[model samples]
Target: MALRQISDAICDHLAQPEPARPLVLSLHGPPGVGKSMFHLLAAHALYNRQPDRPGLRCPGLDCAGYKVLYGMDYTADERAAQHSALRAALLDHVRHAPESLLVVEEYDKLDCPMRGFFRQLLENGPVANATLNKAIVVLESNLGYTELHDLLLRAGDRSKIAPEEAQRVLKDMVFSRWLAEGCEERSDTMKMVGMVSFFLPFFPLERRHIRQLFEMRLAERGAELQNGQLGALQWDEAVIDFLTEKVDFEGDFPIEGAKEVATLMTRYASRPLRLWAAAQQQQLAAQQQAAKKGGGSDGGSSSGGVAAAGRLRVADGGMELTVEPAKALS
Candidate 1:
């Protein structure tokens, strides 16, 4: 996977000894293409394995250690203070845990000066009292989407595009924007572009990829068929097909990606399970009351009848509920 490759690259970079430049990565892609997920997974790969090791911290998406600076969120008046706070926080985190990962969201929205501050940290080893010499920096943006899409199309196959070629294309596309038109002076953003070690492109997810993601999410949520004390839950192909086809319909839009698909599935799938769970709980309570009133053991086990009476059916181009045995576990 591209994420694993990127994680491995970061790991390899971290293994180096006092490298002159920090390992900087620029993730360019459309929205909902999993840039944030990549950051989380990469952190897990780097520090989660042995978290207690001195100076080894898996900040991941932790609000404390893993710092995310949103460019568009800060107003002009707040920008300076935000930058100061960001710098202080970054230094503090790195001082305590040098392996911290810094993620900058909406990189294109940041003012030139703010971008320059980050550039300084990348170019020079230490900023203020903290050294990011071993830290990993990821800047995520959708700035180069058109160019990147064109590059991949011209290559005929995205996977066929060499890393060096992809890097060169990304650098040209990203830095060109940083350099103001008809201006000889290069901005700090342009300088930061030069410091990037890898330009990881998150390709738009395909329908099949969305299907896989749906299945994975289903497994995570424990939405699977259970039969007579079955140990493992079985997923029905029908439900997977229903959600995948729904997502596939919305995939034509440029911004419609995994996030939208996941949202849709959650909305449609989660409700039925929730309803069934509530019904099952009520039935169980009723059964407990009956047992307390001298009912047989069968009364307690009959609670599953409520859930068994719930069925998931696709109708009118969406999921509709009916009263039947629900083969799936909640």
Candidate 2:
């Protein structure tokens, strides 16, 4: 669902004059699915908040938060530090805030029943230091239902999982772990004494969507920007078509040709850079040999050099930033 739609539902629940379920909106999805951007936009649209401030907190755990001291390997001590850091961050956010909409980017970083306790907190916001606070917790985890379950099997990270059966295996593993840890059972029996739990669906990637995403990015990036609606970038139509043709739309692999084009453009940013790098590379060794024989380097040439050069060089005076009157006739 769109962020607004979901937020509206949460708002409806809040407008209950009394809320049965406090606003815990879980913006979950695998990376590259635009979840983070959505999280930012949602926070802005709903809470009038920026991530840098305290009014809204949607923290993502980095290696530091994981307490892996700079270049040190992951150890129990480091994990302990990370755990402590995470708990403190969560508690701090919940303790004092006008609107508590916590988006925990990687909730799965927590160990064992830590997830269970956190989930319980989500389903039942508890009292801290004798004060009552109505807070919402969104646990962002890629483990999904099955992977989390699969993790509990042998008490190790390595789960005997098949590629195809990954989802089911994960679900069962997490479910089993929750059951074993007595969290699911306890939460169910006690009617969730802390916070509410909600799962955001993992989005499927599509090439068309990726292309559109690039266009939007291009629009946002100054390659093209007109109005609120993103228009096609100023790239050559032929080049755009050529790119779309090479990009695999049906191969199931997540390939983004437009992004490749953007990178190519970025690398070929300067005239000398493009000439020495790309345009010159296309001239071929045979051409170089021919050029050497002819005394300089323009060797066994391919007329395609123009096209390669064109990739970097725009028309000489065709596209200028500041326009001058037709120079009043030479």
Candidate 3:
């Protein structure tokens, strides 16, 4: 649902002229539920320049047009000063990167005044005469996390939860929290909150999602080793399962989601992979040296160098690196 809404918003925004206001979205969920990752993925998809593609020069968070501000970076003690700097920076960013992405993480942490700045920016449609209607603005918060988490826990299956019911629960929680924190009286807060075009909720990731994340991280790690001229380190599905199982879970969902997956990977998987790659490289080098010496001493040559192939797996309650002949990959 979140993906569909975001895709539709992007497609519509790109297909038409500048909108009257920026594409404002509010993402609410618990920590480690991919709220922050959403902005990163969106930037990569929109800005990663490919052959015959129309995009920014860089990809993902590397793009100059992608701006992220953390709430913790600003304090109430310096709200006045920070507000000046923020306003100037935002105005400058919009003026330069008309078609841009701006993500504010932990947005609810910002003081009422700071949020009011965004309220004006999103409401008035212009900043210092520069229009922001070409940008995609995302505000990320964990405001309704408890409510959503409870709902997910009750439903057991995420698909069983009604979309409208989830939205209503999240929206109401977020609005109520914001109203209490931001406004003294019930005045005009809804006007600012209503500026958000979509309220996207990131549900807790399931085990399958956790497994997929492990695969992606492992694949990237493999590429890193290959690029460094190390021997290939291959793994079977069992290794992925092993790593995925190492993650702690709460009920049907991962406790930390992708947050702890990296640490767990490094602790459990990285050392084994590194050792395997290094050992394989050393063994291959020794074999090649022996082959070269044999060819020179005897007036005979051998076929191609021995191909070193190994598979990493979980066997006998421990990590097993098995060297074997390369077979056709399924």
Per-residue lDDT of 268 in model 3 = 77
Off by over 4 Å in 2: 2-5, 16-21, 26-28, 49-74, 130-133, 144-197, 221-233, 241-250, 253-330
- On lDDT, the candidate that comes out on top is 3
Candidate ranking (TM-score, best to worst): 3, 1, 2
Candidate 1 colliding pairs, count: 0
For model 2 the TM-score comes to: 0.52
TM-score of every candidate: 0.75, 0.52, 0.82
- Which residue runs of candidate 3 sit more than 4 Å off their true CA positions? 50-62, 182-187, 219-242, 294-304, 314-330
Clashing pairs in 3: none
Q: Tell me, by TM-score, which candidate is best.
A: 3
Model 3 worst lDDT window (10 residues): 321-330
Give the per-residue lDDT of model 2 (tens digit) for 1-330: 334446665566546653444555444344455555655555455554455565433333211111111221236767667666756655665555524555656644455545655555555546353111344445455445233232323333222433324434433444554456564565452343223333344433445555565445434442322221222123343433433444455353244323354553343323333233332344544455665667664444442212121121233553311111122211
Residue range 1-330, candidate 1, lDDT tens digits:
357568677768877887666778889887788898777666655544544456654454332446666654577788878878877777787898776677888776767666667767777777777888777788888777777667767776667877777778778877777776423356544666678888877766666677788778766555443332112323466777777766534333335667767676667777765565556557657766776566555555543332243455554545552223445435
Between candidates 1 and 2, the one scoring higher on TM-score is 1
How well does model 2 score by local distance difference test? Answer: 0.42
